[model samples]
Target: MALTIGIIGLPQSGKTTLFNSLTKAGAPIGGYATSTVQANLAVVQVPDTRVDALADIFQPQKKTYTTVEFVDVAGMGQASQAAKEKREGLSPEFLGHIRNADALAIVLRTFANDNVTHVYNTIDPNRDLDSLNAELAMTDLATVEKRIERTKKAAKSGDKKYVQEMEFLQRLQETLNELGLASDVEISAQDRVVTDELFLLTLKPRMYVLNTSEDMLGEANEVLAKIEKGEQVVPESLKGELKGIAQVALRARAEGAQVAAVSAKLEAELTELPEEEANEYLEALGLPQLGAERVIQVGYRLLNLITFLTAGEDEVRAWTVTRGAKAPEAAGKIHTDIEKGFIRAEVTHFNDFIECGSFAAATKKGVQRLEGRDYEIKDGDIAHFRFNKGK
Candidate 1:
């Protein structure tokens, strides 16, 4: 199954714009009141220069890249004043869309556009982030409280496991009530089993996406310099905007969340152009790659996943696996039969294989090794498994 990351933010924060840029789906972009009522889902191939290089070397009939699924959820916000008193939690439909997501990309608007109205009627990324976090925390607190109550009832039966679970749930409830993230609390290996079942939003891996103006797409460093030197002294007209983005970066660093700045509008436009034209445009703008690509890569890594490569005359493909996955588990990604056969695997590092120019050459150079099923796969490993047909 493809790993999924959900895009979430306030209305008009560019969540849909980022989704369109990343997936090239051409989803509609609209004002604050025009939020998408339904989630938009797309699977996108992860771009890897190494994959392209290997494909060139092998001249394979087919080349495949690892993919990630992006779900652009509608903007979430406070209930209307009339309904605020009765609003207990997030809408059930919104929870359904986000519950299964492996990670989240919280898009925060930093650019000032008079034409595009902010949900809060102001341009403050930090305030927007806090607002969203509060809602997510409230949702998690509700989940934890319900679990605590149920676990308490079960513990009355004197089951030791239930008692322990009750204690854990209470602790989680306390943390959530304090407005702390579920991910921030440490839990035992055994307790993790229960936490995973809750599917708490605050527990998922998250990153910040700072949506800036097109003029600031590749000028983060320059923008920062101006901000640090004082906006008053800096002649740039967008100094205030740059300062807003810098504040978000600082906040993300303090909170240990990954953050990236992107001009979603620019990237969406670039995606509409042909590949060659896009590359040329990026070159003209002095950008190494699209901001959307960086966001995808960051989101992929945040999920704690790594890619291993397979190269051959027939096919060259990149496969995704958890960071510490063993050889058999990695094989299971391709086929259960391969994993069930349970044999040794021939492994070579990508760089070593590329240097040797061939598997035989790598073997001759003593870089290729026969690894058992217990061997843990590393990122960039080129693997060939040898397994018995009759298992």
Candidate 2:
């Protein structure tokens, strides 16, 4: 199954705009709260230069890129937060959409517009982030409390495992009550089995997306570059408009979260243009790529996923697997039967293959290696599995 990430933020935060840019779905964007009552889901191919380069080299009949599903969930307050304050927790319909998401992209608005309304009547990304975080934490706290009660009952049967589970749940409850994420509570490897089943929203890997004004895009990129390069100085002129961005960055650093800034309105407009025109427009704007694309790539990596390639005259495709996945497991992503009849994988690094210009030349240079089922797949590996039909 394609990994999914849910897009969430306050009303008028440009989440739908980002979704439109990422998926090119052109979903309606407005101030109406009911507009997003039903989640908007789209699967988008991950943009990879490596995939294009491989397809060029192989002259393949087909080229496939790994895909990720983005679900534009409705603004938070419509159901979840209202229910949480009543001590009832998230509604089933709302929970169902996001419960299975592999990660989350929290959209925080840093732009100021007199026409577009902010739910809180102000543009403060940090405040918006904290408000959303509280709601998610509350929803998770309710879930953890319910599980604690159940585990307490189960412990009465004298199962030591239940007792351990009860202790873990209580710890989770305490952390959530303290406004901490379920992820903040460190647990043993065995304990993860129990916690992973909870599907706690706060525990999911998350990225912060700052939706900035078109005029601020360049400055936003500059701020991000400075942060990335570990520069300590900021220009006096930009400090005012970038305060929200700085606040969000500090919060992200405190929690070890990823952050990206984008002009969602501009990106949505760019999506309406042809690819070549869009590239020229982006170049004119001094952007390497769309912010929506950066968010998708960052969220993909946040899930601890890596892409491996399969190249041949027939096809050149990118496959997604969790980091540290073994050869047979990666093959299983293609077909279970292939994994069931596993033999060995012939592998070459993408860079090596590009340098050598062909498989035969790579083998001549000893760059291609034969790997067993136990071999851990690495990113950029170009692999071909040889498996028997009758195993």
Candidate 3:
């Protein structure tokens, strides 16, 4: 399945605004259904400096980069009676998009705009967060209920597998009923095969985005701090962007989620400029890259994916495969024929090959070695496949 992250928020909370900025596409952004009937889909390139360095060295005929897909969905909470306890669970159509995503980004408006209407008419991040979370939890709970019913009937066949499966699903259902994610519960290998298809929406990893105004970009945290302290955080007016990078780094150990802050408006403006101009603007803002790149990178991690490189004078390409992909499977990514006729692979770590200056040099220096089909591919591997192509 394509890697996706569904974007949903309250009306005029900048869902499409952020989407258009990330993709540089003119997806509609407004308050009415006439403007956004279908979720806008776009695949943004995953930025990696290693890919660029490989291209510089090989000067190949073709270069390729990995990508992440984003689906911008319409606002939820359409009914007065349907929303439970004043929280707008996702709309059915929007939930369809969210159910498939590997991760999620919740865009909470911390910015002020008299021109744009907040569905709640207040800048309350906690309120927005609670509404979104409740919706996601409800979606997952519905999935678990269906699964429990099916598994319960199947257990009547006197099969031990069904018993084990049902037990696991019951625990999962209970945890999700408590409004927790799939990751919140641990699953054994045996249990995983059973619940794999539930496709529970809240089971997805999530991050928080605090959209602020220009002037308050630096002070966004102080406000978040105040909110975390349970102090009043209602904003009359403030300045920042469509993004606030979460207050944690990519590698920080976490049980549930990550947080980021960014000015989506600023990133959108930068997207309209040339690379040189964008770089200058980013420098002025004291940022590393567009918030979209960070989102893509972090979202990629939610899937436990890594990139392996292949470089030659003929072609320099980056390949996306799971971290534990074996040699034959990695070769299969290039061509099925190679996978079918796999023999051995000439493998050299990219950094070693680069340091030694050439493949032959690396092999001679003992940095390159031959690996069999059982060998698992590692990130930054420079591989040459040895297969029976004539067959």
Candidate 4:
């Protein structure tokens, strides 16, 4: 499957800069707030050290890593009450791109650049989040209202199905009306069939990207570390410097979303340098890795995904599947024929393989196991499917 994450935010939020840093596509920046007619897209390989290690050991003909596609669309916001009332917050073109994305990477600017203007004339990430939420909720509200109208007309047939659907749509309509996310509303299995078609923006998993200034990068990293450590309370001393970041982080935690802090300007510049030089620069800044990398990593996790490996002299590859995927379903990720003709899977953990040095060694050490159709695939599992293709 090709995973896609939509990059969206208010105007001048450095969303394009962050996109360039993530993809190294060098997309042009500094345009008007809504100037992007078409989304800038790029498929970026998900970096994994395990794939490199397996490649080194097997010396495969080719190494293939799983990838995530990023779509950077125009900034979305018409925050006024009038726009919400008219249901005209998001343009149709923008909706077409974002609605299909598996997840969302919402860029929130905390960077203070005098030359580049902010859409709201001030930087308040929490307020910006509220505005974005309102826009999305309003959009979803329109969708629900239309569905309710149809369901109401359909219910006149005195069918129980339409009445049930009408009730669910009414609940969704009420939730979206109050600016609550559709995701927060309880959805049953039956409701999923209805919600799936609506593609409610508020229901997509999201990661909040705090675009910080270069000078505040260290402070931003420190704050993020604290948040990751479960220190929910922002310290008084560092609060002023990272107020927006801290606020966003807390909100992300409350909503079970992901949060990343990145100096997009610095990271984009680093992308222009040699790899070794870039590493040295990051070390000089006391940063362990690029912020753009963290954003990508978190976005992948937001989709509830896991990576399983396939190793051989012919190819050392990484494949993605949803967490808790059964062996047969994972085999299907390789090929539908494999799933149809499924028998069993020879699986070994990457760590165990490394400890044993090779598949033969792992099997000899009794670390390799044969998994059946009921087996759940785990991250970093080196798998070889045993199937009768002739079947």
Candidate 5:
């Protein structure tokens, strides 16, 4: 499955800079005012050491890694007074790109820069989040209200299904009216089937990226650590500069969302250096890894996705599938014909394969097993599907 994440934020939030760092695409970054509605897009290969190891073992003709498509969209929080008056929070062009995204990476500025001015003239991530959420809620409210009108007419036929839908739409309307996220509304599986068509912005799974200064990276990580440990209060000296970061972290935890910190300017500059040199520079800074890598890894997990592997002399490849995906579904990621004709899967955990040195050895040790169509695909699983091509 191909997954796309839309990178969105208020103007001057360093979203483009982060995108450049993540993809190394070298896209131009603009200032506070943007003149173009066009979005920057790139496909980033998901970094997995297992793929590299498999490649080394198999000496494959080609090595393929799973990928994530990122769309860097500008002009999210730019609704004018007239647009707000009409209950429209974003331009149709912006929504066109965002609506198709599988998930969202919301950039929140925490860095202070003297050269670039903030859209609001102050650095407050909490307030910025509120502004963004309110706009999303407004847009969703418009969507729900439209659904209610149609469902109301449909309910007149006395069908229980329409009545149920009407009830759900009204509840969504109420929630969106109060500036609450559609994600927060209590929704059943049946209701989810109905709401899936709305493409409500607030309903998407999101991660908050705190764009911090180079000097603030250590402090930001420390604060996030405390927050993760369920610390309710941070040090007094750290509060003034990191209050917004702490607040956003708390909210993300409460909502079961992911949060990451990155020094955008620092990372962007690092992209200009060679990989080895950049790693050395990061080591000198006492940082473990690139912030861009963390964002990609976390964003991958945020979508509840996992990777499975296929190995051979022809190719050693990584494939993506949703967590709990069945064996046949995972086969479909390779080829539709395989899914249609799937008989059974020979599966071995990655670690077992590594320890045994090869598939034949793993099978001899009973570490490899045959799985049926109902078997769930696990991360780091190596799979070979048996199927009748004539099917």
Candidate 6:
């Protein structure tokens, strides 16, 4: 599956710059707050060393890597007034793009820009976070209310099904009112079907992107370390710029949300350079990897996604699926014929195959396992589908 994530933040947060860096796609960079009015979408390859290693073994004529799609959304607010408007915040266009996304990445600007204005006039990341959260929460609230109304009407028709659904929505309404996320609220599997179409924003998994200024890239990353350690640090002069990101990172870390920090301006500029020149710059900056790459990896984790390999002389390909996918379903990702005419899967862990030098070597070492259709595929498994497709 091509996983999708929605990118949202206040204007001038370097969201578009970061998007460009991640996907290697050029998106218009706004000079000031509110310059971006339309959404930019890009499909980026998920870089994996495993794919490279598998390619070495199979020496495929064509190699395919899995990708993630990101959509950069404009109009989310960090201002108090805009935050107030967020209760009814989502526009038709925004909701249409976001509701279908598998996950969300909330960008927080920890960078300072005199020329690039802050939406709130002053930066306070906590308040900005409140703005983003309130906006998302309010949107989810509206979705639930509309459902409650529908369920109530359905309940009035003497159908007992709607009665249970009404109570379920009411419970959800109460929980959401208490600032609880819809995903955290308890609901039956049956009731989940009723709310399936709702696509409550808060129910989607989230990643906190901390966008830092050039000078503070290291400091911003240090803040990430502290946040991971459960320690909070707010820069007195840059609270608005830094704290919201810190809090969001802290919250994400504590609540199992994926988190990363990067200087979008720096990363974007780096992306503009040649690969060798970029690495030289990164080395001079004492960085391990581009912040954009970190963001992509974290976003991938937030979606609860895993990669599996299909290695052969013809193709060395990466396939993405939700974590618990079984053999047939994973085969379905490649082609229906493979899944339908399913036989056993000859599998070896990617790491093991890499260590053993080749697939034949892995078989010689007795590391290859023949798994039936009922087998659950794990991430990074180098699989050869032994199917009887009657060509």
Compare candidates 3 and 5 on TM-score and give the better one: 5
lDDT tens per residue, model 6, 198-314: 888888888878787787677677777786786756544344446556666666776788888888888888988998999998888778888877876787677777889988889
- Predicted candidate 3 versus true structure: per-residue lDDT over 72-118, tens digit per residue: 77775444554555333455565676677877877777787998878
Return the TM-score for each candidate structure.
Answer: 0.90, 0.93, 0.82, 0.96, 0.95, 0.89
Best-fitting candidate, measured by lDDT?
A: 5
Q: In candidate 6, residue 228 scores what lDDT?
A: 71
| lDDT (tens digit, per residue) of candidate 4 on 1-391 | 6789999898788999999999999888854444235889999998899999999999999999999899998777834566657865576666888899999899898988788888889888889999889888888888888788888999999999889888899889888888989998999999999999999999999999999888888888888888888976654555554987888888898899999889899999999999999999999889988887788789778878899999999999999999999999999999999999999999999999999999899999999999999999999899999999897
Q: Between the candidate structures 2 and 6, which one is better when assessed by lDDT?
A: 2
Give the alpha carbon lDDT tens digit for every residue of 66-169 in model 5: 88888998746677777778876666666777888888899999887878888899999889999899988998898888788888999999999999999989
Worst 10 residues of 1 by lDDT: 228-237
Candidate 4 local lDDT, residue 167: 86
Query: Whole-model Cα lDDT per candidate?
Result: 0.83, 0.85, 0.72, 0.88, 0.88, 0.79
In the range 142-177, model 2's lDDT, one tens digit per residue, is 888878888898999989999888888888989989
**RMSDs, each prediction?**
3.8, 2.3, 5.1, 1.7, 1.9, 3.2
Arranged by lDDT, best first: 5, 4, 2, 1, 6, 3
On the 0 to 100 scale, the lDDT of residue 329 in model 6 is: 90
Candidate 3 clash figure, as a count? 23
lDDT value for model 5: 0.88
lDDT for residue 371 in candidate 6, whole number 0-100: 95
TM-score result, candidate 6: 0.89
Which candidate achieves the best TM-score against the true structure? Answer: 4
Looking at candidate 4, what is the lDDT of residue 193?
96
Sort every candidate by TM-score, greatest first.
4, 5, 2, 1, 6, 3
Residues 1-391, model 1: lDDT tens digits = 8889999899889889999999989887764321235788999999988899999998999999988899988787844554334434566677888899998999999888988989889998888988788778777888888788888888999999999898888888888777778877889997999988999999888888889888776676455434444453322334666766777666665566777778888889899899999999988877778887888778867777889988898999999999999999998888899999969989999999989999999999999999997899999999998888898
Residue ranges of candidate 6 with Cα displaced over 4 Å: 31-37, 78-86, 177-180, 226-245
